[model samples]
Target: MKNLICLTMLFAICQRTVGQQVELPKATFAMHTGFLFGVWGNYEARLGQRTVFLTEAGFSFQSMAVFTNEGKEDVITPVLLVGPRRYFKSKISKKKSGSARITRGFLGAHIKFKPNSFFLDSDGLYGYANHLGVFPNIGMKKTMGERFVMELALGVGYAHYFAKQEGWPENIDRPTVDLRIRFGFNL
Candidate 1:
């Protein structure tokens, strides 16, 4: 009888431990490859079950062809961003604990601090330009297992750039677009 009781307790403890890891992620390591910001990455931390916050940093390489004497030049810049993301999960889902994974879709947003680019101006001089932009985004996330999730989102926002050198057109601002896809794992 004692052996039977011990086995039953062990079984119940095992079940609870197994159920603990199947739900919401507290944090994630994320990667970003986008049109506006080039290739960048970030870390996301969940503020709640359906909401998370993120920050990004990476590099972008740009090459420009010149009609003048300089044939081609490459400019590499560092990129950084910070923002929050909120997820809206689907209702119809696989259920084991009578609870579903809230990972089907999400509506999110971000503010990206643009990387600087170097360009050879008409005066035959290289100049630097940097921008900061923010946008609201929408995305979808899927969890393959206990730790991995994939996401994609689209956003549009306004941006402005600052140039360091004199006569470099310091105040340059425009509308920007963001299309991003992320593959991440919970931490």
Candidate 2:
């Protein structure tokens, strides 16, 4: 059933990509940290001058604390930050021997999903929570130092968790802050 859902979504994405007849530049790949946690990478193809089809994947190892004891778990995450990437147009030139670095900033929205993991408390009781959510994220990309280019983005979203058989509270508190940040370089 899960495979079916994933295939359906994949088909939808393929349809969108094939439907567009615009000729654009090749895809760009990037690796970054701060996407939820750990390291993540993305493949972005320019669908238009200000539009991008961004696909990202990463993993996060985290420990969560509820009203009970903390549980350590591993989660897999994939995100698509596909939307209009707002940037300034026109170009500037310098008369120096070397050209100056160009920096651009953008704000966009994305939809994301994370796989669940086993959560074991101190009492040996365990449960799992899988979340699917969306958030509005903003980021900037520019040259730093002489050769490094970096991008950072942060987003906030509300997630609902479904747990298995455990006396987990009926009204559990949500995370005080559900934010995702990614710092990576354009490749």
- Over 53-164, each residue of candidate 1 has an lDDT whose tens digit, in order, gives 8887887655543222546666555667887765554533556766444455555556787555544344544545566787666667776555665667777777776644
Error of 2 at 156 (Å): 3.0
The residue pairs in collision within model 2 are 34-181
Model 1: which residue pairs collide? none
Cα lDDT tens digits, model 2, 12-42, are 4433432213232366777777744667777
Among all candidates shown, the one with the greatest TM-score: 1
Query: Which residues of candidate 2, in runs, are more than 4 Å off?
Result: 1-25, 35-37, 61-63, 66-100, 117-127, 144-147, 164-182
**Candidate 1, which segments miss by more than 4 Å at Cα?**
1-23, 31-39, 61-76, 91-102, 115-127, 164-166, 184-187
TM-score between candidate 1 and the true structure:
0.60
TM-score of each model, in listed order: 0.60, 0.57
How high is the lDDT of residue 84 in model 1?
71
Predicted model with the maximum lDDT: 1
